[model samples]
Target chain A: MRLSPRTWTLIILAVLIALAPVTFPSAFYFRIGALIFVNGLAVIGLVILFGYAGQISLGHAGFAGIGAYSAALMPMHLGLHPALALFAGAVLSGGLAFLIGRPILRLKGHYLAVATLGFGILVFIVLNNEAQLTGGPDGMAVEDLGLRAVSDALGLGLRTAEVWYWFMGLVLLLGAFLALNLHTSPTGRSLRSLHNSEVAARTLGVDVVRYKLTAFVISAVYASLAGSLQALLNGFVTPDVAGFLHSIEWVTMAVLGGAATVLGAVFGATILTALPQALTVFQEYEHLLLGLIIMLVMIFLPAGLLPSLGKTLRQGESI
Target chain B: MRLKSTLAVSALAMMAANPAAAEIRLGAVLSVTGPASFLGDPELKTLEMLVEEVNAQGGINGEEVVLIHYDDGGDANRARTFATRLVEDDEVAAVIGGSTTGVTMAVAPVFEANEIPFISLAGAVVIINPLNPWVFKTPHTDRMACESIFTDLTARGLSSIGMISGQGGFGTSMREQCIDVAGEYGIEIVADETYGPRDSDMTPQLTSIAATDGVEAVVNAGFGQGPAIVTRNFAQLGIDLPLYQSHGVASDAFIELAGDAAEGVRLPGTALLVADLLAEDDPQHAVVTAYRAAYEDRFEEPVSTFGGYAHDAFWIMAQAIESAGSTDGAAVRDAIEATTGWVGVTGEFNMSPDDHMGLDLSAFRMLEIVDGGWSIID
Candidate 1:
């Protein structure tokens, strides 16, 4: 039985997610695996914005911050269940993107980048300085999601790391499936049309601005959901969720892994997230070595890891 | 399929490469680089030197002690990852490290979840206030510092005072702690002012503090050059009221920054600052002077209370393992909780189950800056 490419992507992602844990040295690797999925979730959103629609957003972490703080704050303040707060964060992020994307998406090139950068910084400053609410730079603790407790009550006997590992893996699979399906859907086609050339896409009767905004809002929801999961998984969240560096990191992960594909998001997020954990043995030289490794990758794989590797494999077949 | 098989083979091979069973593995996740390096650098140095000494002395219980440490780069997120790595991958008996309150709180849940004993070096009341059974710390919390400062104020008969604090983690938390406990000390906070971590001039804030009625004295809760800048501003304003600072600025660099204006300023400082001034018979004098000499000799850097926190934490963990007679996590935790009258660089520690920090206000000595040097005040 043959599988469609979309079905093939989902099948591969699911298998990899299940199979990777078998190689884990211990339960600790589960936490690292979960960290990759969380970051990959945010990077997947970037793939939709930058990859599909050719729109850029340096403030997606702002939406993430809103989502994380929603999980952290709404549970404590408004007495909302944590799972419910995640949906609230998603809706809020989409609404915010809809409002801001209208004005900011009109810019092109570096101007858009700088404008988005300004938006990210504004969110970070507010989160950091609002001491009364956010706990200032000291950061605040998050409520537990209680999934481990539920698993224990059901006699599943799962640890925190393992629970998050399987939960986030399932979330990543669903996310990847949706993104892959969107790649061929009408809206997805419209987004891709705008990505190739906005002027040309408009001449083809596609609402380029509307498509771009749709991608922006969709990506924001992705980032926000990822952020909420990160908070719940780690059982803590700081203003760093909305910091400028975090916003930049998501884009870097998306682009480095071949932003054009769903699999690329997983690869990029895993490499960037797990590299430091592996390199921590370097002690004082960790940062230096990390920079060198990243630089080498970009120089050699200019089109990104997945795409470049796929191109090489295709050429080999032709030969 | 090929990559999966290869990865499984490698992972199996790695797991088979475990260390000797007789060796006691102690894991650490420290901020040995980045913004908090001043604190973590000396901590790493202290741990390295002490581990070498311990292993050289025929080890603990005739078995070698192995130290497995990771540098967090002062990032709280990395701290959590390293915490899990310490407990699960390395599978150490207990952990000792956390350079900042932010980092400590970040990893506290990891240790609590795994039921591994953790001795934190960070100085935040929250680290110990809630008192997780598996978590303990060495440094005097900010609450203790605030209480120590207020004690001096009440003794000096200064009931009314103005306050200025920085907006960073240390200052902000310490300021809140001071306000929370001020009523207990009979100290009335008449005026409040603040400065950012990078503010060059605090004259405006200082001016407001001085102009406030019944402002008999001023207390500054901050570290780094923030207090130095405030001292300069206070001198410029010539308010004439007594000025007090937190232990955050107890180092000599503050004296250098404030220069002549540092005279007559009092703050809570560790006994390490006045080690030479302490009586030879004093219990803390020997411990502090030895640590100070050893650290300064080995690292070629001036000793700091930050390093002292690590020094105490290492000994506390070592003592717990020695007393427990085994490296079992629960056994070592109970041993640590049972600690009492243990003398180290920080002070005499009297750890109880309820008080994980184990140090009291006496851990902080009131030191006055006179003639551009620290003077132990009675």
Candidate 2:
């Protein structure tokens, strides 16, 4: 029997995660791998907001900043475990997205974009200006998540980066699985319908406001958790995590990889993450080269990498 | 498709094959291409220049030196990854260079975990305050700049001062450091104010400080053109009080931006600025002059204090390795900690168990702007 598309995507992702290390020439790649997974998880959320719901958020990194600070401050101030702090940050980000989405999501197109951008900048300013609490622009250190200790106790003998790589890979797979499942669910259909036309979906008896809010809250939680994982992995957190550029980066990754697909977002995350590591060999010209390459890709693949490639393959097959 | 194929191979290309043995590899993670590139670019150039000089002189301890470095683009996360790669992939004997305090702190845990001797070029005190065993720094801390200005203030018999600081990392840190250490020099801060990094005008903040009671002098704790704008605004407002700046603005860029207003502006800076003015018999004159001349000749640019930080970090690492007589991590770390009487472009570094950054107020020369040039006042 042929496996379902969702099953195939999960299997492929798991295989890729398990197999990528074999190609790694050194342990340094483990850190790079972990970074890709964290970023991938974030872009997956972008797929839901931008792809499924046909809405845009330019300030999702604000939620990420909130999540990262939760990991750093919660443990030190509230005496919570670093792991629990991660959860607290996710809940906080979700709740904030819900409250903010109600009024802001009413705006369409450029208005919505500006509202989200303002929200992001607001968070960045707060994180930066509240130097007394957030360590200001200098940022602060985060406590370890104690997963290394658990792995050591379990006799896994994996290194810190390696442990994080596998854990984050599992998280990304879960994120992808849920996202793929949501694509075919009844609520997912409504969300996708709104993407085509909100007015049409509303006339068809869909609760447009509730669907939009749900997508926003879910994506915010995903962004928050990704931020928490990144902070915990690096053992450091900074305001840059929640900066506007980082939010733009998430959108760039999602759009680059075909925003409508879960696996495509992951693929986008992988290339963008790995591209910088690879381009570092260019030395001083790295930024110039990175920009040129991204522009070239967008010019060629207007519909994005995965969806465009899939269409080309289908056309070829029909011919 | 060909481009995508090249992209695939590029990730693999990062995994360079390990070089031949019998060479001492020194890894560096610097902000060579980002917001802090001013600091990191000169630093990377200086380190490359130093390594070339060392190798041309026929290698240290008969082993050829290799510098494996990465441009972190001033991102802390990238700095951490590069630091880890230096430890796990390159497996260098020692590591140096984190161009900002944020980068240094982010990269510190990796070096500490791997037991690699790290010499940072950042100016934050938090880097070496608690004294991580494997970590040392080259440049004087922000606190030293604060103390240097306060020392100059006390010498001028100024008991009260007004301060304006920027909101950037270097500015706020120096401001807090100044506020923390003001009592030690018997200097009372009569007024304190702050401005954002992008604020084009500081008239509001400066006006308040000038109007404050018994304000004998004004101090600006910031880097970049922010301090230059402050100097211009001070002139515009005609606040005829002594103006002091942090070492963060110890460059020709500040003087040019402030124009005529910078004439009497005073700040603490590295000896490199006044290398030509040093006494012939001065210990640092020879080292400082030689580096400035060579760097200027080679790079076709005037030497910066940021480059001086890298110069000091490199020399300190070399001296530690030479003293230890091996490339072993623990030995090099201990040797770096035990360093003493080592003179470099920055200052005479004297490392110890308790003090990883071993510079005092004397390391900073109180420089005054005179006719668009730096003049040593103390």
User: How far is A55's C-alpha from truth in model 2 (Å)?
Assistant: 1.5
Instruction: Extract clashing residue pairs from model 1.
Output: none
Model 2 regions more than 4 Å off: A317-319, B1-16
The superposed Cα distance between candidate 1 and the true structure at residue B135, in angstroms, equals: 1.0
Question: Per-residue CA lDDT of candidate 2, range B1-378, in tens?
Answer: 323432463355356657568999999999888688999999999999999999999878888899999998888888898898888888888998899887888899999988889999988888988889998998888888888898899899998999999997778888899999999999899999999989999999999998898999999998888999999999999999999988888888888889999999999988898898898988799999999999999999999989999998998888788888898989888888888887888888888889998877678899999989988885
- Report, for candidate 2, the interface RMSD: 3.9
Q: Is the docking of candidate 2 incorrect, acceptable, medium or high quality?
A: acceptable
Best by lDDT: 2
Q: Please provide, for model 1 over A197-267, each residue's C-alpha lDDT reduced to its tens digit, 9 standing for 90 to 100.
A: 98899999999889889998999999999989988887877777787778988888888888888887788
Residue pairs whose backbone atoms clash in candidate 2 = none
lDDT of 2 at B254: 86
> Ten residues in a row with the worst lDDT in model 2 chain A?
A278-287
**CA lDDT of each prediction against the hidden true structure:** 0.85, 0.89
List the DockQ of the predictions in order: 0.42, 0.45
